[model samples]
Target: MVAPLSAWPWENLGCFKYLLYGPFLAKVLYSRFHDQEASEYSWCLHILVICALRGLIHQIWSSYSNMLFLKRNFRIIEHGVDFKQIDKEWDWDNFIILQALIASMASYMFPFPANLPFWNTKGFIAVLTLHMAVSEPLYYLMHRYVLHGNSFFTHHHSLHHSSPVPQPFTAGLATFSEHLMLAVIIGIPILGASLMGYGSIITIYSYVLIFDFLRCLGHCNVEVVPYQIFKTIPFLRYLLYTPTYHSLHHTEMGTNFCLFMPLFDAIWKTLNGKSWELHKKIRSNLGKSGRVPDFVFLAHVVDVSAALHAPFVFRSFAALPFSPRFFIIPLWPLTLLALLMMWAWSKTFVYSFYKLTGRLHQTWVVPRFGFQYFLPFAREGINKHIEQAILRADKLGIKVISLAALNKNEALNGGGTLFVDKHPNLNVRVVHGNTLTAAVILNDLPKNVEEVFLTGATSKLGRAIALYLCRKRVRVLMLTLSAERFQKIQKEAPVDCQNYLVQVTKYQAAQNCKTWIVGKWITPREQSWAPPGTHFHQFVVPPIFSFRRDCTYGDLAAMRLPDDVQGLGCCEYTMARGVVHACHAGGVVHLLEGWTHHEVGAIDVDRIDLVWNAALKHGLRPVSSSC
Candidate 1:
């Protein structure tokens, strides 16, 4: 629930909310352009840099803490963050915006130190002493009494507490009034130092950076601070708070209301008794191995910008269907830098996870992109990554590992056939997930249809779809130039049904066929040959565009996860909420069914209906696509 207080006016702007700094940015740029003295725009530039740095700090902590490879065992809360939490905390950086705006205004109203030196030992000491004396207690008092005890403040502060599993940005997720109070608490020491003629640029930067750093650290949900220090110096526990310490506040609302220091909590006898014990307990388990997921979706990055859609990078962005955002264009440099780094030193990593029916499901990414898969030289490297991932999953005793998108490319690794062939003794099931993919596409076709046009006629999915349709006595116009491959697939069908599969090499052959099954991308000219109202069913990667207005296009094969799925905070590429590509769902079905066979290489045409039925049996529903 939203606080009764009014929200930030620019809340709906989403990414454009940063434009609130336009006036300050313009003033800084204009002042610099006019060749003014350093003091004229330096402070404004400082405020901008500080705010950006604060955001960067939060991003770094978020990335690190969410990295299961790094700190999975150390997680205080094992449950995944859901879409509701993500939507609520979408504007986690609102406090930074508020801080920038207030600081910019205060620069004009108050007489800040001008032409300040880089370092001032006296100023640094003064700020620290003043924070300990004034800021800490005042914040604790307001947070404990007003925020918790009063009705209005309680309503707003509840927003922050809503996120039971605190993330790095969760520290800043609050209402305008709460942030305003916080700004005052944080500002008191800096303003006090300036008034006492002890302020320096270094003091302001150092103090604020530490403040932001500690805030992020406390909310990171991982126990990074060593308990040894606290063990040695018991007094230090009162002076500082750990991630586990603050997490208790969110879970147990009435206790541990101190800002960054536990001293006040102890003073007021409000500290939770479990804070230190829980901190030590979580820290002790940090070195142990993490739990293995029941199912793993081996996925690959699509492109540079889409990398940001990884749940760890941007929770809110990943929750929605992915599309290129103009606002994300500015961050291309950082993503590009990350891309280059991954290209140089990338490995398969756990990208996200969730739970369904008591089973843990994880999505792992092979740091290669879609374009990289097409490169001849990168094929071996990509396969090596996939192979290693399969081996790791096998070692971890994972029940099923599903290959998604290009990860199961026949040309690259024979749809994950290479690994299964070489490691025949492997215990883990390597599933291409194409059986269900074919099922979803073929099932969507009208049963009354007498004929259908097929492209990529000899591909694994195309072969399965054509053979399945042939068994139903549907005349299939298989579009292929290679007669040998077509003949081979035709020979596999029943003798009586074989005549239904006919080879057609040209797009003109499909002009009269209204039901077109596209497994390969076709050009506008080729698409033009289709008759008006032709419904195209596809299982193509980077699904084809709807070039003809007279015809309709279908999305790639996908299925909606069961309603009981938990912690499903991110979408699977362009799929809608709770919907996942059929291949991914295929793996889930495999796990739920406890299927023992390795579902790699060629898809089993006979099992299409069985798998489809099994999916329905387990409550997985096909994602209905119009047109």
Candidate 2:
């Protein structure tokens, strides 16, 4: 899936250096009065041109194959998970130069005939047979001994072992010393052919073409070779190597050391015995069409801390420089500054929170803006950042994104209508995630409670919660910017309980309130404000962003996420893993139910049971605690 092109660290630099080195090499060789050779400038030009074309073909073909798979089936390929790093294939660009050098060895120009017999013309058939015979034993020796025996060479060899699924360019990517050794290995066949008075440039070119093609095929994930053909010619199955055979050398690295032929591996007993069975299974699955997922959930929050753990941390901000043109001045500029500050402090992974379930479902944690500093001061720009994060989810093939914390406030009147309006064609749905939030809080409402304090009582969630609490015949203490806004509350709140609602400027022990609804970032810092036996139901982005004077991590240690919970709002605040905010718990509920459509604001009291029932269907139940 596309996770934004800017997300990759494909090092396409240093192309011009080689472009310049071509002329330099030709001049130096000419001055030394060396034997005549093909013009280096022409050679570099040809190599660079072909390399660029081949690179395009590789990217387009691989991406198309994946897209075709995803569209027809439910599951994405392993490489498609986070968009596999381009590095493995990208390092193989140097091979184009080797091809150019081999082409230069020709006594004449290219586009040579393909079907000349072994005794007639180039004698490639005979040379290819001899080369394979000689190279197989040498390949086995190099791989089994020198490559693995020497710690220095093994260091280079270990890189190839990193990716379980090798790609087209994976064959050529190696350290310079390793490349030199590999060059000598290839040179053996060429030098021997030249000395034997047979094999010309046509032989070398044909051999290189077939050799490169076969190596690429060895890494390609497709298992198109017919099983029946191998069965019919049992000896042929043992004679020729398949992609599955080479893949084992990467995954089960101690086995399958021989290349092209399985003779050495058979003799040495290093051939992977399980490859045949595995290949048959893969081929069988490919024939069954594609595997689709159940659902996709994306989490959007503004967390700068996670950005500190990214690989190539500086590269994470590569798009920030060009962002100002697309965005208003101060917004993009401020975000750029914030990213720099975070990086200066050694932050990383502001990239993405990638995870997939055993059920083949997908989930993502997408960060908005750079950090918390932009959350308030750059509020206008924050929406764009939220949109961008959702857009990133769209690129990741996620179908829905849940707005978290302050990000929820940026949605259309907090309903996400503005987001839908801006991007009408977006595949990833914008979810406010408030329905589940309301469900968890109401489900946990304490019985026999006559009085309750609502901190930030006039805020959307707080007001809805406060008014609902009043409907339950519970006395509500409304703590707002202005307690006098009681006129608004009196107008909106239930008439029978309006008189029970107290407008308070400050918390007083005399209120005798045993329960409080802590707002976003609100903490009764003074111990007197929260009298002994006072319990709170915090429902903020981080339900425990702050704590009262007497509290510690240990004080809130009893909080644990319910069985159905995944994204815990209090995750960053606590070392304990299971603590969740009433907000994030809502998203988890949606994920558990496979609901894709947006559910915003509070669920009506009458319909609260519907949400509760859905949660129960997913094996979820409220943790019955007032605090």
Candidate 3:
């Protein structure tokens, strides 16, 4: 809850912040902007270079400092943890370069203020001071009224708040409109300064760099600055925006609005009293750092080959008495071997993976894991193994993880709800990766097909696909486990889609519908039910190892990807290039595109093209778009 403005610790210090920061920051920013003579490109280059430097301060220095603070001072609470990884999908590939490129374009189109030497040395300082001097009102209004106010949060701004715990670069997770609005907000002071003849080489560089780094620093959950620092300079409480202060806004939105200073919050009476205390409490319990996967794939294996040999194990156990002593002894070795094989096969571990290296520093942050993807049928052990893997990833600061195809079903009946239900303490997100699958299918649906038949329609992937199709008025003959299940799933489809959707309890009921896709492996009977000339695609895992005449096994393989984008068996990329499954590919696309939420059983239809295009550049073909 927020407190009264007069009750704020720094309320009386508003005058002090304006008085002190006015000239202090102005003098430092003046020489940088006014003294140097530079071309527009040089000015852009200066911004680009300073941005790199600020990145170091934000990502490396402050991150390391935050880590140290967590290590030294932060301790874990009973139900809470400190330095729990925030979902960070930002780097040159995902966000920074994109933002920089856009900024560069904007700057090139509308040049920055490159004014002459100050008529008076302190003359330009006033303009720079005036720029900051006006910050109190505008920053507060944009953040409070426009961002958190109403529908703005629902549509544009709240996307940034989607990640409860934000990382330094997670700040880039806003809607395109929000990002554009922010560019305007940040340029306000500088634009005003430019008008007053305060624009110089360093002015643009310092304002852009300092503003960028500070915004990132504020979001960094690591509270590196000791409370003593605040005591040392009590006035800083009013002037400087702390990491803890910004964190409060994310945790409980609407408290702190001013990006650079806290006095505005004090003046507006929207200050959070819990910010400093929670920060202190959280950091006190920081845990030790360790290696974690970029994602954790829940897994199990059904030995297609091993199942044939399984009768031996049961036969031996049934004949435990050994009617003939010699034969019984012989059977013992086979039983032991079978038990060993079964035990060995069921064990879980970090399986094959490919790493995406950072472009700027080659930082090894996103190491995508395949994690037991080749296995299936682990109900008894799946939960334990999945939990263990998530914990392991959390220890290493891995913010996001996900379950693979079969594992996803085993975990939550193919939904994220179960993970939240079972493991509430986990700070990590369990991405289902099905959202983009539906998107991919919908995006690439054959234009000639008026109706699509979907078998196993009650499963998460199938159900999601049905909803997406029905929304587009595509007729679906949906087959499910039972009439009850079919109706339940059908209820979720758009009411207007009754004419467009049909429910089928058996494969026989859907045969006439030409185009067919099975979200799960169908029984041999279902396969036999396929009519001649029907276009069929199998969208499940541990795929039908052999291709059928009318069926495409595995969505990615069905797409007939380009050489560089095809999988080499398991989820591991060949030469660490190409994507394994379309679901996994979708996850990578989300990260590279800087999406805020995890792509689960549902995806936005608009993003399908974007993910598809990204996959194409890396060698994936557009086969799905064709017949």
Q: Pick the candidate with the highest lDDT.
A: 1
TM-score of 3: 0.40
lDDT of 2 at 215: 67
Q: Number of clashing pairs, model 2? A: 18
For candidate 1, list the clashing residue pairs, or say none: none
- Residue-wise C-alpha lDDT for candidate 3, range 1-627, written one tens digit per residue: 322221223234643523422332343466457765444235455545655675555555333432321232332211111111221232211234444545555555454533333243343475457545775567678789987878777766666776544556566566555555566666666566555655565565666667777777776555655766676888887888777778778777868887778888888898898766766555454343422335444433333222221111221111121122343455555555654564555434332332332211001111112233334553445555555665666566665665555556634343555555666676666566665566566655676667888976776667767776777778888876587877776776667875666776778886676677776676666676767666666566534433357654434332333442211222122112223345555555544555556454444444555666775555454444443
Put down candidate 1 lDDT per residue, 528-606, tens digits, no spaces: 8999999999987778887988888988899999889998889988998899999999999999999999998898988
Per-residue lDDT of 104 in model 1 = 80
Give candidate 1 regions above 4 Å deviation. Answer: 1-6, 12-17, 33-40, 113-117, 286-289, 327-337, 343-346, 375-378, 625-627
lDDT of each: 0.89, 0.53, 0.53
Residue 139, model 2, lDDT: 77
Write down the RMSD of all candidates, one decimal each: 2.5, 14.4, 21.8
List candidate 2 stretches off by more than 4 Å: 1-306, 309-377, 388-399, 410-415, 421-428, 483-490, 509-511, 523-527, 541-582, 591-597, 601-606, 621-627
Instruction: Give residue 170's lDDT in candidate 3 (0 to 100).
Output: 60
Q: Over all chains combined, what TM-score does candidate 1 have?
A: 0.93
